[model samples]
Target: MTTDPAARSAPRSSARRRNLLLVSVLALVPWSVQTFTAGSATLLFPWGLVGPATGSVTTITDFFLRFTMGLPDYILVWPVGVACYLVALGSALSGVLFGREDVRLTAAGLLLAGVTQLEVARGFSVQPGRTAWPVGTVLLWAVAGFLYWSRAGERDAR
Candidate 1:
């Protein structure tokens, strides 16, 4: 290891940029999968796109997609959830880029999003299979947690 702080920081800077870029890309990832009893499904991405799914039941795609995706058929769906998701995405992005507390904001936003979606859902039910995991949400939170802890420790050690 060289005693050059600049050399050490170069890698750290690159890693930071990569991490932020990953966070941004994660927004395009499907945050959740809504499956129906009829063997059809839908993917709920953060950017508001719903694609067909092929898995066991977890959530009613029509209900979940109505609030989360707002497909053309769901033009009259509630807009508040989408707006909140946008806010959460912004917070998550800014937190990663500017090194701010993000988990809380993200958690809160997601909680609100779920509630709003639930509100619009008159009645729905589905059995979540083993494959029913929100991969993008899990990854984002995990990476965010790591970044938060690592950055905090790095500053404290400095």
Candidate 2:
């Protein structure tokens, strides 16, 4: 049996576009939120990422109130997660644009790393008064899982 070149490429192109679209929307959603006695805060959203409240989950939460860490608060506020998030976003975009498998896989891994870091940090700092919701972290993992399994399956099939 012979496959038409254009037909095979069409599906791949469609999937790539879907991936780019999904990540673009995911990146814009609110990644985390917390409500303290004082007020409620949502972070890393479309506006927060680019507007006045630009920072990682930790930094944004810290802005509202100190996390009451066993270690120095600086440890929690480190930009590791932020860096991972940015790199993942960049790789995902570049991968789709250039059709690079390695870059796409790296993006999935980095997305997991970045979200996990933020989730861990958030867990460490929970206290009595504040209600924390790692909604963004949870959603990001779902997206990463889809990207990873879908891409890995495609690579393995070849």
Candidate 3:
């Protein structure tokens, strides 16, 4: 009976590759969510106050007028939003092509979650200002990163 070195090493190599892929996938979730949420707010929401832009047009308008007043003449963040969308689209395409589908999904998830949080915060505040929104954005990103790290470790073990 004999065992080849090449054969033994091959399994380890494959295992390592699989481990890397798993980690990438897991890491992608939070990033995607944050990216998606941000992108959505800029692209979808009329006011471009990223993260959970859930509110009536009036509410959204008020948010923009109150907080983002006189910053720029631009009414909407559509241009920046378009650029972000392209980046997200590219990230997704690259992830899929490189066998890292998780990255794409993660980005989307991050964006959505972040934007949703923003929306929620604004909706609740009687007179929303710039003060509270940044906090929400930071918290969402932190949670997303934490979740990604935790999930990556769990997935690799399997």
Candidate 1 residues lying further than 4 Å off, grouped into runs, are 1-5, 53-133
Q: What are the lDDT scores of the predictions, listed in order?
A: 0.53, 0.58, 0.42
Ten-residue segment with the worst summed lDDT in candidate 2? 46-55
Could you tell me every candidate's TM-score relative to the true structure? 0.51, 0.65, 0.29
> Per-residue lDDT tens digits of candidate 3, residues 23-53?
3443223221222322433212323333445
Ranking of candidates on TM-score, top first: 2, 1, 3
Candidate number achieving the greatest lDDT relative to the actual structure: 2
Full-model lDDT, candidate 1 = 0.53
Ranking by lDDT: 2, 1, 3
Error of 1 at 55 (Å): 15
TM-score of candidate 3 versus the correct structure, residues matched by position:
0.29
Candidate 3: where is the Cα deviation over 4 Å? 1-104, 107-133
* Model 2 misplaced regions, further than 4 Å: 46-78, 107-110, 113-128, 156-158
Across residues 41-146, which tens digit of lDDT does each residue of candidate 1 receive? 5665544446455343333344455444534322223356556656666766665467553545655555555445443332222344313335444654565566
Identify the leading candidate in terms of TM-score: 2
Candidate 2, residue 150: the lDDT equals 84
Q: Please identify which of the two predictions, 1 or 3, would achieve the higher TM-score against the true structure.
A: 1
